[model samples]
Target: MTEADFLQLPDLAARSLGGAVVYANDEFFASRENLISPGAPDFDPSEFGHKGKVYDGWETRRRREPGHDFAVVRLGVPGVVEGVVIDTAWFTGNYPPYASVDGVNLEGYPTYQELLDAAWEPVLDRVALKGDAANAFVVDDDRPWTHLRLNIFPDGGVARFRVHGHARPDPAFLTGTIDLAALENGGDVVACSNRFYSSPRNIIGLGRSRHMGEGWENARRRDGGNDYVVIRLAGQGCVDHVEIDTSYFVGNAPGSARLSGIPNGDAMSDEPSWVELVPRTALLPDCRHRFRVDSPTPVEFVRLDVYPDGGIARLRVNGRLI
Candidate 1:
């Protein structure tokens, strides 16, 4: 894959999706919590604190001995990571010169001590890094991992850590009717016509978006056509219900929407490849539109089309796996 092709995959370590930095060896300069912020790191050259210049990232004190600095992260959606991104934005001088990553799998939440003693395997070996840049690495391990350990040479700051992969939720919790288009259920947005304001993948995120920025918003359309997003389902299933949430999108919600699916198909072709699940219907701003669908044909993919283009908070295709 290309250097950034992995970005198309879901980020299982997003704070918005429940990820957290469980532990850190030290954070005398900046808090470790900043490493997982959902938004990009912020900066203010004139912003200084009692310690030194304030930084929006995890910054440990310079080591005095022969050890290094490290932090542990609990992935929101336990999955086999395909790639990693160590973003050290705005940390030009204090960014880590090199870093490595390791991962571990466990049944339930392990105590801090137990996690420290687990047989963590290396996912990405030590690699050089440039300050104020997002370092990307594609790993080879395919085993599902629940946690990750980041090791920085000696000590320094890091803005963010992204684990890109698909979710591997426990099968027990996936029983009964479930959202076939949920990121936590292994579904992912594969393609989209526009993502100028926000990522189309956000529509598959859990719950209603807190604001317009949390959902997918395309730029104003000039091309006579509309906006659309294609999703690969968690598994082959017949859609039973659908939820289109436009919460917090007061003035920019889509005027109307249509849902279509491809039964017994593994790929997306032209419109002829899809069967109508929900016909184009009018939509209101900041409202939840729930529709009962009786699709009997098992589908592997689904598509949502918005007329002329606008914002969409969340899309749920509920069904049972066949």
Candidate 2:
């Protein structure tokens, strides 16, 4: 019964009849927390969290500044509103060369001929997109909008924000959703099997040794971690690397491997935990699908140890999860 008594959102006509209300605004793209976007499904960005947003000021400074990041809501609830979907799966903000709102006075212009003398209409169809790769304008055309007004300029970043139409049970439509592996236990590793690629001329015995048995042998270059493969992004993020495929391996495709994780330090236990292994890329045995594991400080679990050749078949988490 909070989040402003469930976004009572401009009170969508005092609610009740049919329900719907989806508003989010913590700026920083709705405070991203596990939101991957690419062909979706099994879509793991690391899980996701933080279920609270809906700005217009004060909630301890609703994302503070730049007009408190913006988020005026008031979705429908009393039937017949028709359409309204605006999921930018993940979008950030930083526009000011031009902008417009008028009634609410968001007007700002400095170029584009003063933004066509201040007309501003296409806020990119109101905004929506999910990302891990393979992207496109997810939604913004489905229009009905009882009342919304994102508007942010001074660094914004969002992850997900669905609001399909058909109104009826306004419990504030429960805002964004992100579940991070049911909340922690990324330990008993389970998937990322049989991937391939290698050939300096078939580069000696390299076929997953009949099924990952013989010293787990599948070497390409060789560094140490006895090959590589690890994931823990059931939560936490800001990572930006990881995508791999060799088409099935054997030789001369080893140039990079070794990535560690967990580093926000001081959960304390004798304190020495500060893992971080780097080596983003370099295994282009003619490349195949995708690979990245660059970090900018924000982790939860990840380990890709394969000095010479570990093995892989599928692993992607461009954002969200941890």
lDDT of each prediction vs. the true structure? 0.89, 0.34
TM-score of 2: 0.20
Estimate the overall C-alpha local distance difference test score of candidate 2.
0.34
Best by the lDDT measure: 1
Predicted candidate 2 versus true structure: per-residue lDDT over 153-222, tens digit per residue: 4333333222222333322322233211111112213222223332111111112123222212244443
TM-score of each: 0.95, 0.20
107 in model 1: Cα distance from truth in Å? 1.4
For candidate 1, the per-residue lDDT at 204 reads 92
